[model samples]
Target: MENKVATIYKNQLQEYTQKVGKRLPIYQSFNEDSENFPKHRAKVLVDGVEYISKMTHSTKKQTEQKVAKITCESIFHEESEVESFPFLYEDPTLRKSILNEFVIKKKMKPTYNMISQEKGQSPIFIFHFAFGGKTYIGEEAGNKKLAEHLAARTAIKLLLETNADTLSPIIMSKVNSDDYFPKCSGNLQGESSSRHKRNANTNNERRNKKRRFGN
Candidate 1:
């Protein structure tokens, strides 16, 4: 059974590579122990990025096929086909849920920097988060919360694209959890308020001087 699955995965991978004009994914395997049982772990690299399988399997061939299947599905399928996956959350709440997964379960801290701001306008924010030793920057957004979500969503997409199987069990569980919701942080709120107030005051002072000078 494992051999049949491996052969199918390999054929699918070949078809995908031909259509996309990319090289076949490279697979590497190693022995590992899981719950005191001997297991084989496989990692596949597509387009120079590594994607790991979710778990070690009884056979190296099975592990390799599982990893290849995941990569092929992600690369060859349409968005609707893959939307059911936890890592491709399109909604803000889901995105925040994944972010919390990184924070609470993965023990990673997320930082939002107000990269640009103008008076009487929504500030531009940049969100920074790290995964698997790689730092990812989210697209700049008009507010800190939105930026953070974008950052988290971006990170999640990249992880899924390259190595969704590598995610920790706790993190994966959080991604699939139904109860996860966006929670506001007091510190982030305070920082935003402070910056807005400062910008407002500066703008007001400029207006006052202009009025006084009859300009």
Candidate 2:
């Protein structure tokens, strides 16, 4: 139940908005308590615009983190050349899903380009994903699939970290892969969880009020 990456993004995003004179970030989730499938998608209201994560995740934290990370990317790079990356899943299939998620969220299809270099005897393949006019290049690999994943992984790493520079030095230093995934947690997560529960309850009450008025 550790959601380290999500906590980092949530805190950094809040701090970023504060620095830029924006209101506190607001979050809402869809289908977060499914009886059978614990699937959910998170949306954030920032600067009067709503940004929702394209893919549904198994947990509320994951979905919220995805949306928050993308929202951070949008606001951080709005006036600069910096870009945002996402957390790619370890499984190859899930890793590719992250790319699809990006396309859905960004409304841009990334074109991949590959080049092969001759090694001692065989050739090594290097792949690059051309996304948002930025080229994320991967290391040379023995085959095409591995090379493609490597490139995608590199893109996710760089895209997310670019905006992380705006975070505090302590938060920026915590963005390592080992800790950025689900394996790590912060002391603030407990407070965050409570705040999210309150927000969720408020959202539900508002929805009910709307229904009552409509009826």
Candidate 3:
């Protein structure tokens, strides 16, 4: 029999899927040994991936809820692992720029979830965003906004590296500009300043060489 707790978990799972903009479908099948038997098998599909329950239950609702719980856990685990890149956290400005150019401009909502919070520990947050029907998950962070930025940065970096020509002109311009590079301050200020000067001198030398060669 399907208890109230299982029902609640099932409902919560459904709500979570809807909040994340993913479709979760629960499918039920009957035992073939006896057409009139009450035993039912349940399976669920999350993001097109299917998960089946370990065994059939007495009622369809029980079977469905069991399958739903298993599927929900799997979905959450996969989404949590989506944050594969750790370097995005170093540049929040560039991250925000990526989000503004790609996600915000595309008119898709960014979803966030606080995965865990323990006493004396930073909260773990996950960010989710979709583009062209494909959802991208961001690396987990201590704060919601940071997690969102990380996610946006990951998506933008992946797109820029793999599919730059497919990006919009505005985003492409931002990616190509040195203005979007990470700014240094405090302890790193001296090093960054020296590096900038070196780059400028190199550019001037290149320009002078070009002029001399008439090319």
Cα displacement (angstroms), candidate 1, residue 53, comes to 32
Steric clash pairs (candidate 1): none
Which residue pairs in candidate 2 have backbone atoms (N, alpha carbon, C) closer than 3 angstroms, thus clashing?
A: 84-159, 84-160, 85-159, 85-160
* Tens digits of lDDT, candidate 1, 1-215: 33443455566666656667888778899888764676988888787778888887888878888887687666655643223343335556556555555454455544544455554655577877654578778887887778777777777766665555544343446444655553434332444446778999999999999999998
Per-model TM-score on C-alpha atoms:
0.38, 0.38, 0.34
Q: What is the C-alpha RMSD of each candidate to the true structure, in Å?
A: 18.3, 20.9, 16.7
Best-first order by lDDT: 2, 1, 3
Estimate every model's Cα lDDT from 0 to 1. 0.64, 0.65, 0.59
* Comparing 2 and 3 on lDDT, the stronger one: 2
Off by over 4 Å in 3: 78-215
TM-score of 3: 0.34
Better of 2 and 3 by TM-score: 2
